[model samples]
Target chain A: MKELTILSGKGGAGKTSVAASIASVAQNAVLCDDDVDAADLHLIFKPEVKEVHRFEGGQVAVIDEEKCTNCGICWSYCRFDAIHTKAGSGFYINAYQCEGCRLCERVCPSKAIHSYRNNNNYWFVSDSRFGPFVHAKMGAGEDNSGKLVATVRQKAREIATETNAEFIINDGPPGIGCPAISSISGVDAVLLVVEPTRSGLHDAQRLVSLTNSFNVPVYGFINKYDINLQVSETIEAFLNKNHIPLLGRWNFDVNIVKAMLEKMSVVEFAPEGETAREVKKVWEQLKSLMLTD
Target chain B: MKTLITSTTSTPEGPFDKRFGRAAWFCVLDEKTGESTFIKNENAEGQSGIGTKTAEKVVELGVGKVISGDFGPKAKKLLDKFGVQMVIINEDLKVIDIINRIKG
Candidate 1:
């Protein structure tokens, strides 16, 4: 199955909206939300969870106060001030502060600090109106988002293969960070939803380079293109220079937000509207390109 | 006692940097001798895990206290585990003024 990841270098570039709309148009597609951090694709898909799995991301050191001999060895050895000592209480580990390095656990003369995997993170397989969806929620201050993204993508791929789905629509996270890298790696193609602003163009250029490094074919579309026509033109020029096809330029439309409020794709919300037509056109162009390859 | 303060510049006269992991410089102040030295944060431009690296640096320096506008979750955990005093100063004060405040 062909996998298409919709990525944006900056957040609020309508990546989820575009991906949701494309999913509504594409047939035989398994949708996956790879944006574990601040995941919002669920806001539109309204997935009914089918399966839930715990994500044991990383280890966090825990201190047993009862086993105390407060020699301060663990305190001095720990680099992450995760261990705190109260006047009455000996020492305690701050779950939020801990990176789970386990240095304190090892160095403790009293052996009071024990490290354990934090199983707070969770991923889900759910059914949405579009199709089978794979998504995850990373616990607050949770590490290893890249791993969580990979996990969901793997499940989505497995489901796609078993069901003979033709495509996998991945709603990727913002920025060129680890999660973005995980989402782009080995994807069949990338669709960058760019905004018409100076930072938008700059960040999209970075994302383009990142995708290029992974040897992934990328296409671009300017979201809210009319907001800054000059910047949109510059973005188009950059995409052209990089040999990336500009699929569609969508005008600034308030209906997109209205559609989101109703938890529906613009195409579903307004089937015959201009915005929906533009989204459908973009999907058609993307499908044609995918078929040619 | 050794105290580390995140700074925007390498000099003590520079403003205090709010970010801990991405701070440009770390001003190490000697409380006993009243002398200060600046260490450039090599992990400032790192792609990831700079908080842990910065915390390791603070530990390696044997700093007893850290003064910054804010510390990341990882850094705060490391510093707390090591019993390092963390002082949060939200005001936009110069490095010198912070140093004086600590001295006082």
Candidate 2:
């Protein structure tokens, strides 16, 4: 099956907006939203979960106050400073601070420190209007996001295989971090969704460098291109210089936010509008490219 | 007393691992004498792909224990598999002093 990952270098660059729009137009497609940390695609997709699975990303160390001695061993031993005393009574592991290293747990003479598999993260396979959606939720102040990304992708792959779908479209996370890397690796092509701004251009550069390093085929699209005509021009030129395919440019349109408010993809809400037209063109291009390749 | 300083960043002065995004440095020190040796992390492995594969390399550094800035669940799991000690560093502090303090 051919896979196309929709990625943005920074957040709030309309990556999900574009993904959802394109998803509405695709046939025989499985949508995988890999932004497990701050998953907002559900806000639009309104998925009905068909499966829920535990994701064991790592462990978090905690101290048992009842176990007697507060000899301060764990406090001093923690390199991440995850241990802190609350009300001077006993030590507590700051969930956000804890990296689940288990050092303090091992050194405690009183055997107070204990490590447990954190259950703060979870993944799901749900039925959306578009089809099966593979997604997840990582608890606030949690680690192991990259693992969660991998989990959702694996689920998406499975669903695609079972349903014999021809395509898997992933809405990837922002940044060049573990989650982003997880989404891009081994994908057939990367559909990079870039916004028109100075920082957007810079982040796009970094993301391009990251993708090229992996030797992945990349296609570029500029969201809200009309807002900064000059920068959009620059982005097109940059993509051309990198020899990446320019799928098309989408102009700034409030109908997108309106579509969200109506709980519908822009393509579904205004099938003949400018945004919908561009999205359809992009989808057709991807479909033909996959067929040819 | 033995102490370990770990970072996700890899550097030539210390161990260099590409798997980590600047969180791949681990410097083990002798708490009593203040002498330290670098683990030479050939790859700063994150919790994905070959980066996840480097957990064994990190275990080979022979640290009696470690204090680190951040570690993912996979790395923590591998560390458990190798029986390496781990301490979580929640705040930004002097890496050396934290190591010495943990050794005591």
Candidate 3:
């Protein structure tokens, strides 16, 4: 199967919109939203969850006060400064400050401190209008975003193989951080969407560097290229310098927003529109390029 | 009794380093003998766990006090357990100036 990912180093650069549009056009595909931090592609796909699984994050240490010994070893050994004394209360762990290293629990002389896994994260396997979908939602301040993303992708690959799907398309998270790295690992190709703002160009440069370092093939396109044509040209020059192929550019259009509000991909809402036509053409070209390779 | 001061360089003339973890030098001052020695900080450029490393060094050296601009939560916790005193100096000054102030 051909595995493709949609990523933009900068947020609000149409990664989701482009991924959703491609999802509508691709046949025999399984979709995964690797943005567990804020998985929103499912909003457009509206997946009916077929399977649900809990994701266990890092371990957090908790101390029991009734154990009768205030040896302070746990307090001394806590590298995160998670242990705090509250007036009358002897000690408590500040969940926010804790890195879940489990050092405190091990150093506790009274065996009062015990570490527990953070299981407040969940991932889903479901069916949407476009195809089979895999996505996840993690609690605030929960660690292990990269691991969660890997889990979702693994499940997506399983469903893709079982159904004999031709493509596994993923909507990746923003920035060249952990989640983004996890999304593109071992993928066949990456679709990089860039906006035409100064900040957009700057972040896109970072993403391009990251992708190239991983030696992953990248196909780029500019979203809202008409808003800043000068920036668009500069982006084009940059992509040319980097030897990354520019697939196509989409004009700044409000119809994308209108289509989203109507809960439809641009392809589904306005298949005959100029933006939709360009997207269709790009997907076809991208698919052919993958097949030939 | 010994005190540790975060410094920018391994010399008395160098300025004090406000950050404890990334300091380039650690100055150990003997209150009784009025002798000071500077030690290079190997963890100055470390990306993570610098606080823990610095604090562990302070504990191993058996310093009674630490003077720096700020201390991270992790370093502070370890130092507090070891019963080491902490002093924060926000003003930009030379290492010599701080040593003089301690002597005065």
Candidate 4:
């Protein structure tokens, strides 16, 4: 099955809205939300969770005060200042600050530092109106978002292959960070939903370069293109100059927000509106490209 | 004891920089000897984990205290683990002034 990931180099560029609309339009597809850090597609898909799995991220060090000989060796050797001493409490490890590198655990003369994996992160497989959906929720200050994104994508691919789904629709995270890299890696195609602003163009440029480095085929669409016609034109020119396909330019619409408030895709909310019509056209173009490739 | 102060420029007269990991310069001051040295932060423009790198550098320099406007989670954690004291100053003072305040 062909895997299509929708991404935005910068947040609030309407990436989720576009992904949700595509999910509504596509038939026989498995949906995956790879933006584990701030997943909001569930706000629209409202997936009824079918399976839940714990994500054990990296280790975090905990100091045992009772075994204490406060020789200050752990403090001297710890690369991260995660261990601190309170007046009454000897020494403690700050869970929030610890990277779990285990360096302190190795150097502790009293053997007071204990390391353990954090089980706070989790991912889920669920049934949505669109299709089988895979997503994850990251714990506050949790690391390994890229790993979580990879896990959900793998699960979605398995479901897609088993069910013989035609496509895998992924809603990717913002920026060219680790999670974003994990989302686009080895995907069939990338659809970049960019805004028409200076920073939008700048970030999209960076994202396009990143995708190019991965040797992935990328297409561009300017969400709310009419907001800044000049920047939109510039973005279009940039895409053209980079030899990337310009799929569609969607106009700014208040109805899109109204649709989101009702937890509905724009196409589902207003089938006859220009926003819905443009979205459908983009999906159609994307399908043809996927099939041709 | 050595105190590390984040600064915008290499000179002590330069304004203190609030950002710990991405600060342009780090001023290392010897509290007892009253000598100061400035080192350009090589990880200032790093894309990721610059906080951890800066914290490691601080430890390598044997700094007892860190003065900055703010520290990222990783830097704060690493510093805390190494028994380094973190001091947050909201005022826009020069590096020299902060050192003077620490001295007093």
**Cα error, candidate 4, residue A247 (Å):** 0.3
**Per-model chain A TM:** 0.94, 0.95, 0.95, 0.96
> By DockQ, who's the top model here?
2
| Candidate 2: stretches off by over 4 Å | B1-104
User: What's each prediction's TM-score?
Assistant: 0.72, 0.74, 0.72, 0.73
What interface RMSD do all candidates show, one decimal each?
16.0, 13.4, 17.5, 16.5
In model 1 chain A, the worst 10-residue window by lDDT is: A142-151
Candidate 3 stretches greater than 4 Å from native: B1-104
Judged by lDDT, which candidate is best? 4
Candidate 1, residues B1-104, lDDT tens digits: the string is 99999987898888787556667799999999999999999876553566678899999999999887555556767888999988866555689999998789
lDDT of 4: 0.85
Q: Individual DockQ of the candidates?
A: 0.02, 0.07, 0.01, 0.01
Cα lDDT for residue A194, model 1?
Answer: 95
Candidate 1 lDDT for residue A137 = 89
TM-score of 4: 0.73
Chain B TM-score list for all models: 0.96, 0.64, 0.97, 0.97
Model 4: per-residue lDDT, tens digit, B1-104? Answer: 99999987899998787557667799999999989999999876543566788899999989999988656556777998999998876555789999899889
